[model samples]
Target: MWGRSVPSAHRTGRWDTGGVASCFGSTVEQTASPGRKRGQPGACWDQTGANGTKRVADCRHESHTSHQTRLPQRSRTGPARETPAINHSGIKRSFTAWRASRRGKGLDIGRPPEHDLRSIMNAILYVDRTGIPWRYLPHDFAPWETVYGYFAAWQKEGVFDQLNGLLRRLVRETEGRHGEPSACVLDAQSVKTSSNVPAAGQGIDAGKKIAGRKRHIGVDTLGLLLAVWVTAASVSDNAGGMHLMSHIAATHPRVTKAWADTGYRTKAIEHGARLGIDVEVVQREPGTKGFKVIPRRWVVERTFGWFMHHRRLARDYETHPHRSEAMIHIAMIDLISRRLTRESTPNWRDT
Candidate 1:
């Protein structure tokens, strides 16, 4: 009860009032050690029992030091249930209809596939949403090589593109619109590329200050993707826009009217006009300050936002621009399929 002064050397160690040794993250009181120098931080104490037995306290945080206060052994009942972020029933059910349609079209060939179609789709979606390298896919899914093979096969055979069309039409019809849109919005986004992307395929966008590739997409009023084109960032908006509008003209001929930003000013307009389509540039009001949403253009911007929700589309990782376009298509297909199934879009956050 009487204390002239509490020295700083022994400040870190406290006197123990409780003699029992307890563990499992319980507080440990250390007996104060005189001359507890800055470099000498360990505290050990000796206690005498009523039986005249001497008990040594060996509590220390250093390696290889053992203490009587041990934590309980883990129950080790079993591994936790596997909750896949992209392998939910909603996605599988939606894909089932597309697979059935393929069967109806006599799309089957050769022997049966080695891996389950459902597992392959799950692996593909997992890679897209998490942006992990193919080799890094979890062992619980199919082999990474098989998954990539299916992904590339789907792209090369136009299976993904057709699936995208089916999903897009379904979403449009779900929203009370015709399967084909009469009006659309067009836009481009420049994203940096991964190192694996060849220098020949990469370019610098002086406008957005991004050095990589450009994504030109046309979307309907509901923000569903109509077409996507990936090119080097060096390509001007006019060029990308022409390519994009031509795609819309060929596929969604009903999209007679389209809206774009100021970047697609002159040549794109003429190109669209020649294609029997009218392209309008939605400009922000002159006096507007920060982040004003331009009419008929924000929809395409929102579509781009949707692409970013899938981590693979956050940057250009594909070695070929065509594959980049395929990746984007997969993202959109995942989106529209979920929409048709009335399920929430699978996101990395849930993983």
Candidate 2:
């Protein structure tokens, strides 16, 4: 009975294992005694033979134990992977969307039958971003020569000047017809330039009181750039009074009050009076030994800060003054677009 006891039908097949059946076609039968552990070592059986004839065999227990022991433990957590960085396609799509918006408004002509507006804008953006010389603009963005040609053509045609005026007017009209600003903030900033540009001659040098050119800007309360004029650095602020106010009066007839610093005290007051504008020059305390910046004069300074975002405006890069002014208009367009888009979006306050 101890010699490999096989279980009968009444037994739940367990150890005291005995004969095996055919292993072919995957099903192999093993017989074990009643109430014995089926997989106990040295007590299990398997059969292997051909044509329904089977051989009884003991499965090597040591080999089975060793095989189980060699398997490596698996982790409960899953495998590792990688993540992507930037979406270049998304940026391209945004640029295309912006361009399409402009085209829908008839503001963008894919290209000039002679010169393309899209290419012109790209060149201007490139130049402004890089602060590079116009001649150095890459050929892919319309020839640098062509970009300059169109730039000059637009300036002489007064397109930039007109655009600046139009933007200010539109903003004013939309803001409940406030009408032209009665008061304007005036400020001047020095734009350092390459020594290559000719120095201001005697009278011009005497006027600005500096070595090179200076840019005087006038801006209204809403930060709209009104008039921009370039003169020699040495030109006294008061000296250009007549010319500057003339430019302002021509663009904005309703300007009645002018605000300026002490440098513009006399002439701005005189010009304002003549144009029916009351001049309000922020006065500095005479006895104050320390240099103090004026507060109300900062509006124009803020507009200059806006322009500085365009790298090209940080310095005057153009060989001609008017071309430099055109770049300013392009910067204004960018600013207006951003402002308008923000205003148009819903829940802008939460954003």
Candidate 3:
């Protein structure tokens, strides 16, 4: 009976090697032992062969086993942090603070309007520092047209002349309390222009080869810009001498002596006599003297150098001479600012 029952069980294909009951397909191996439940999903077993050799087998479903081998999913966070906006007003306030720290005794003109003054001054400084054309100013600041308009308005209103006068008075008062300047330097520089403005025939000097305008600058012993005048470029340096000396006398009453090159020899002496300034020419040696440079008179040369640093001043581009003159004043203000702040670092290295 036991042999008949075993044959019936085998005939049912429960133990055939090529059937579903084969070792590869059957679940019998998982439930053969009464004490063991099908081990939780991915169980492994150690089986002993009849000769006592051991082998390891996995009881896991193929899908579950493959799923366990994959990498973990990642989170989706964004990119890097950004910087904050600049406080331009705060920067201007800081500059004003620095200006206040260095301010000496003077008439109180309570601070200028924040935006307008700052923008205008910035435009001037930009022109002087970068030596760029006014029309080419960057858009972040005031438009070039606006700045130039304000400059022209100020010139028409005599704002620059007034400011210069005020600075001169302050210096003169200080000098009066101390002593007179030893010597003043006089010189005229010509700015070639395509300007079509008409001026008096007396204002035109044919000798300078300049037909449009001239700027005569006078500097004191300390190389401070004392006075400036704008006239037809045809105006002779001698012709402009009297007016420059008059301006100096009016601005700096205590100037004792003046110096110039041969250009200012004739009329300068006459004007200096009236103003009580002894005019002396820095003489050049005779012969083909390979461009003999004069001392003391170089202060005006230095002033011209300062103006030439601005491209607009390098060539007059304005339709009006007064506009060009206003730009020159702006240049002077920039020079004063740089000198006072000790910010005159050269932008290029000598090559």
Candidate 4:
């Protein structure tokens, strides 16, 4: 059995040392005279010296009053900790201006917003940059659920798509090119999916031996995104190309020619022609052994490389392919906004 005088535990703040002291936390207490006033005699703990002499050590004393009255002590050992905050560098003034103008012109009659839309947009950029789960969002921004709610509503409403398309035109015009391209490069990439991705939304690419989904994209000579389509990996290039042409025709009908690899040679060309696009297949030379740069084809490949810079696009994690496509647009929006506004590159390493 232990001695009755064995330290039961110590008190902290206004908490007494007893049955529930351990649950509150192990604390060091100071001895005060019974005649001293409450505020005059602060709590302190006894420390043993090297010579085994008992000495009183000072401790911050907090009363049972409200939290506002308590002040935390400063330590010389290290800097004080703070909740992490998302960076605002990813947001551009021009982008915000465009959004405000668009919102004012189209829909300004809704009830007042509970949260700032800019905060939600920054939260999304933070998530896309860090590739973190929605639940793990930092406490500084709006709640993750609220941010995701805005993202889903905007995605379904094609808000990002419209913004990206407008920015692409503005960027092209600034570069002394036509706002609408007469020619584009077509390409498809197979991205593996996460384990949580459902089979109904993804399939295996037999040629690439990748079990995932395929993203077929059309980009102008400047490597800016023009159109995008997502499909199961099992869909052949020709089949996916046909679907993508319809989208391009509807969205970017000014594209009269599309440069592609040999995989989209015959039927793909015929289908594109029927949709009023001349599909030019860039075939590899027969004598080439290893590396050969095909003309115009590398532009689309380079655009895909740009997409790879975003960690969220490295794999298909969304359960719905449409959501995955929306994520790609979100990534492209960040890229294009920076290009158009000369904004500094976002510091993703902070998180």
Candidate 5:
């Protein structure tokens, strides 16, 4: 028969071909056909059609052919897709060197990670800098969950605190200063909490009238962060001072004196005495009404201002205060890394 011919089916049953299979009926010719030869085209029998008229159709020349042709070509081998490394605010070589020297001292959790620590740290900084939720991390970086998991782990391990301490020492040494400061400044800022921050994690600051958390910080005379602590906003400066003093004592043994404002005068003195450190209060000028920069106290205030420049620090969104502390360390690393690089570079303008 002309065109393609289909085989006669003894019973009506559906057939499925991996590819589209066109249905064809027997030719109208009276002669029964033999098996198709190699030279003939492929065909299928269609006995279930409404009309019993014999029909012939080609299966290879159907509409579905276009779809098969459009499929991607199979490949034998290629490099697997990988998450790109984050370069922006990534760990510097100096910082890496410092971390390596200190790595075995801590962070010795058994098996290694799939992603490099540098990439993970950069991913974390990217999240903090952009103020995005953990799940919203860009696909180009390591998986958001992985990055956050490492962040939380490191936070609990006090890795960020170690980084902040080590980097601060390096910065101070580069500036021809002692690795440890003898005197430090104390201050606190009350920041409102975001919707993500639970009510259980927050309290109202009666003084600032802010319902959130208070960031209590200790900075060296050079305004470098020595310690950072977060507490409920309702915690008075005196109460926060006790925690801050204890933290400073543990981390910065060389810090013998701390300067603060009137809010911390009595508590600072009392705590400092117990810790064997002197506390000095720098009171605002009696007649000064607005914006007087009190000496010693202004240094810590300026440090707080620097923290404000980071969008993530504008409000407390972290459910845990430890995460907030890690973010602070990340921000300071960004700042001090740039400063260290600039100082090492020669002044082209002067030349």
Candidate 6:
């Protein structure tokens, strides 16, 4: 009635303001009733106080802050600075060399890529190392779809496979070994998968007690990947070993001997003999207890340890077996490329 009139509550439990309601059930008096300014209106802020109770106070004037006032744009004194591309110089160099020296180089005819190839590679590696979804890729890189398209295309075309081989050869030579390994180690790692992976693509691993997929891979003594085969976790070790041996035979013919854990015994050994690779089983010492590393088989085991260094390999996320295998190849490609170029990979320990 004077400075500010508090709304009167009626029998119906509604606050009476003649006819209108605004901030909440309490209505603001539009026309000035007494000493209050024109813009001031009673409000219930729709928020809790520090003590966690609602407080209704006398009308206060506040700005809507919805662009009603014009803001001046800052005047630029120099050209805008672009963000540096994510590609490491080593990765860029390795990919460039592979593209130039690889067979069928003439087939690269096209309108040329809209995004930088190095940038594309950086994006792919980002997803692998971070274990993020394709859509969650950082905005600084190419659009997720474009980057994934390039990944899918390159993976389907065996680009990663070839790149892995090139990097393997370079790393082997750097270690004073021949480009092609005459002996190798074989192993499998079973990991759980995301819910999006269908039951058709997943199976329970009775041995490791993991439910998802298994990665069977062959690697040289230097711990570089030679071949990878992805299968449902339920698949027998012998089956995975057979497929892995076949892949290695087709790709690395010079391999004459292989070492495996006891899991790959008769069928796998027989298959390797048929393919001309003498498979030898590396057994643990009779009375050993905890985590003793066996001879020869330790190389493939070390390769799996390297896989855990990349977060994506901690679990199987791909919908297809082939794409899952490609992820392993991509991990090795990133590792070997950096190793050959003497580039250090960054980790959480970096300041």
Specify the highest-lDDT model's number.
6
Residue 3 CA error for candidate 3 (Å)?
77
lDDT of each: 0.79, 0.66, 0.65, 0.77, 0.75, 0.80
**TM-score of every prediction relative to native:** 0.70, 0.60, 0.59, 0.69, 0.66, 0.69
Worst lDDT 10-window in candidate 3: 14-23
Expressed as tens digits, the lDDT of each residue in 202-249 for candidate 2 is 123444444556777777887788887776666667756556677888
Model 4 lDDT on a 0 to 1 scale = 0.77
Q: Name the candidate, 1 or 5, with the larger TM-score value.
A: 1
- Candidate 5 residue-wise lDDT, 178-256, digit = tens: 9988888888999998998888889998988899999988889889888888888988888778788898898778888
State residue 183's C-alpha deviation in candidate 4, in Å.
0.7
Model 4 per-residue lDDT tens digits across residues 1-351:
122232222423332232122335544332343333434433333445787635243223222222224546656744455545645665576667867887787768877567777789989988776678888999989998899999999999999899888999999999998899888888899999998898888888999999999999888899988788889998888987787787888888788888888778688898998999999888888889876677999898888888877888888888888888888898888898888767655355543
Off by over 4 Å in 2: 1-115, 174-179, 201-210, 285-293, 343-351
lDDT of 1 by residue, 175-220 (tens): 7879999988988999999999999998999988999999888888
**Colliding residue pairs in candidate 3:** 205-234, 205-235, 212-233, 213-233
- Between the candidate structures 2 and 5, which one is better when assessed by TM-score? 5
Off by over 4 Å in 4: 1-112, 344-351
Alpha-carbon RMSD of each model: 12.2, 18.1, 21.2, 8.9, 12.7, 13.0
Q: Write the residue-wise lDDT of candidate 3 on 1-351 in tens digits.
A: 122233333354422222122325654434322334543222233345897634233324432344444546677555543555779899989987876665544565687434456678688668755656678889877888788777768889978766655554455455563334556898887766643444442144467555556888887765667777777676677878888888778767778788888988676798789888888888776664565457887777887887877776776566666666677777776666555444664455521
**Candidate 4 displacement at residue 68 in angstroms:** 27
**For candidate 2, which ten residues in a row score worst on lDDT?**
16-25
* Cα-based lDDT at residue 247, candidate 2: 81
Regions more than 4 Å wrong, model 1: 1-112, 345-351
TM-score of 3: 0.59
